[model samples]
Target: MTWKLGLYALAATVAAAPALAQDAKTLAIVVKGLDNPFFEQINLGCQKWLADNPGSEYECLYTGPASSADEAGEVQIVDDLISAGVAAIAISPSNAPAMANRIRQMAPSLPIMTIDADFLEADRDLRKTYLGTDNYLMGVKMAEEAAKLKPEGGSVCLQLGNVAADNINARAQGFRDTASGEKGIERLTGQKGWTEVEGCPVFTNDQADLANQQMSDVFTANPDLDAFILIGGWAQFAPQAYAQVTDQVMDKLKSKDLIIIAGDTLPPQTQAFRDGRSHAQVGQRPFEMGLRAPDVMLQLLKGETVEDPLYTGLDVCNQDDPGFCKDN
Candidate 1:
């Protein structure tokens, strides 16, 4: 039999089904949104796993909110997935705190884990384990890369997704701590020759268009801004706008007047790096996360004590180097 993978939103996949239908056990992979290419790679990973293990009874049901900004919608989808009685669940929460609260309220009997992002440390026990990148280290790599291009620290901006996202926050903190040359500093403000410039640390809420506009606005406000660290690849997701904006700053980039170290090496983002729009990229392996999630959750279902926080490592590359995507 030929099996196909399709994007299943909550309503179409879960609500339409009878509660806990017994036809085939479901392994649900919930991401922050349906729009991001990063998440699409994850879906592809899950599909690959299914293809490899043909004739398996488990069905990989990948779903998420229509938009990355819809934090509440993601939580609702998780709740509905639970109610639909999926055999196991792997979620990447957009808003970690709210999702943790929902999990506590419902207290699902079936096993649940996190992918790409996890609940905050205070709420760590709520999930079986987390499978994703070492976000803080990912940020540290970005900082290190930026420092290489411009040894003298200068005014900068941090491009992030939702303010409440645990993964994005961790990455931001890592960048700040490493860039400031001080460990555990709460915020970067004139520390060790580095200061996150005023009107900086702009939050894009994971929208590609908004991210590009934010970059343009920040650059406009601070023409002398030395560097930018994109904790998420929002702007680069839209390659054309990214190219246009980078074209404007190409002179600075060439002169080392401005350095950009963005996250993720998806096709478009990598092409942007090749075009010299971004100086470096520190990316997470969402495909690996998706591939490992099903088997990990299955082990949890069998009452096995799996390792918590299965880190899927990083892929660092610069304009001069192609990173791990070179293999593909």
Candidate 2:
């Protein structure tokens, strides 16, 4: 499978960083967390790419923090990779702004490329290119799904992951914009049925226990909650988290009084969709993101230019239209 990046003229000269050895090139991929199945697939994709392209003169070094919210740890990992003289870096930032600043501090010296997530608008120049799903469109699809489930005006709550992540924020805003425009859907805000537990909506930190507790609290507080638009499939990641909500609201789910729509159809999330626990899953190609990053980085290292803000693609899966759901 050949991956083609749209070519462009180089704007600035990118100096190759000092490599570990002259014969082999070392590339680093820093994702949100290895614990997440999505990121695990990404890591596997990178491994597969390396295996397929054995003669490409590149070796991949993959690592990430234990938790998604460990911004400092992620920064340290990047610093360590830089110190080790990695030729290029592909990162899915936990915090976009911080990662962008860090990249800026090390720019030109070390070419940075983003995958899965992206940097902010003002700091986008720090990175060579971004390859991931259209997050805003993902949110728009979530909103459209919610409207489909409840055609006659119902309330919906959004479950989000890290608040500072550019992807999360974009998806949330997209959902809000599209859902607000729908006359039948009312996006709940404030502390009534749709409220934040601590300071924000279920910031799961990619932990199943935290996702379970946060979801249970929301379910307990909002018995009248018509639909849930989960921007991140944190609860579906682990059985314990899945049970936390399923055990509490199994009857409601069976009755079709409440609908749950989420993002990312990993094995567990796909099974949930199959079993009718979740109505739909928004699928993002994280594997492709990983597969393409090294290729893109290699191009940059060789003083070749590619298009900025490259989009992978997205799809919505359900019992009715199980598009990539069956593949999972």
Candidate 3:
């Protein structure tokens, strides 16, 4: 059959019959790292959106950096869901290039949508639609915010997702370009850390935490370290962790102040502010994106041709911003 015909058949097969039946139809969500509240929040947002839509179902599955899944987990989940005949698969790919082939292998009779993060060199031909923030721009915004906070400039650290992931790479590049261009900013590399207590497998949450701990040590080793910026959730938990380290380092330093900044927004980061742990966060509207993603996916499943790209929003949350007391 023609590609166009195949695409139609795929969307129709999912949207028609039980896929569009009176009861809810499943939209399998495959995501990275359920270790933190960030994923939980995103899941809640997606669920809320699906709930509002009604007659739609969702199942949450973790495709973390563990041995069981990793990128393979996401690919398998999509494949399994397709085989089980779910209405749609809304994925936040763990590794895009590695998983793209598996995603593309899905029967042309299935509707697939991506959100939160994207696959490397995604087959736009295979996906019904995509909904997420401009990750690179968000990174630039974070760097700009850090520059504003520290005019003199200093070393900034990156707490990344997966190094191979396209979205994180883009964000890191944007941050590196912006900070390196600044007269005084220096970019610091992150330490590989574990997320869980046991630290069995390396994950973003672990990497983020390790990045924070390394920054703390940097501050201890070099008391003059001026500013530290983390472009991941690491900064959210770093304040308390660093506060302890900073308190120890401060006793021996003439100048003991360090500025902390982060990229993504999470509830813990906001809480850190309440306890005086963080300075600022570059917030992505994940909840809003969640609500919108399903709407976009539903349209695609129904065979309504959508625009090539869709916008999910973002903003900066700081002490000055209203998110101070409100959940970020």
Candidate number achieving the greatest TM-score relative to the actual structure:
1
lDDT of each: 0.83, 0.75, 0.57
On lDDT, the candidate that comes out on top is 1
Name the lDDT of candidate 1.
0.83
Which lDDT tens digits does candidate 2 get at residues 69-120?
6887898788788877888999899988887777777654578888888888
Model 2 C-alpha RMSD to native: 7.4
Candidate 3 CA-lDDT value:
0.57
Compared with the true structure, model 1 gives a TM-score of 0.91
- Give the Å error, residue 240, model 1: 0.8
Lowest-lDDT window of 10 residues in candidate 1?
1-10
Count: clashes, candidate 1: 0
Model 3: CA > 4 A from native: 1-24, 54-69, 122-125, 181-212, 220-222, 235-257, 319-328
Task: Report the C-alpha displacement of residue 217, candidate 1, in angstroms.
Answer: 0.5
Worst 10 residues of 2 by lDDT: 2-11
Tell me the tens digit of each residue's lDDT in model 3 across 1-328: 1212222334443244232344446666666555544555555555455434445454322233333225566577667777877777777776776667776665755777777777665465667666777887887877776666666555444556566676666676677666666322233332111011112112253344565566556555555555555656653544566456545544432232555566665655666555455566776655555556666766777799887556576767665674533543
lDDT of 1 by residue, 100-203 (tens): 99998886455889999989999888888999999999989998898888787888899889988999999998998998888887678877677888877889
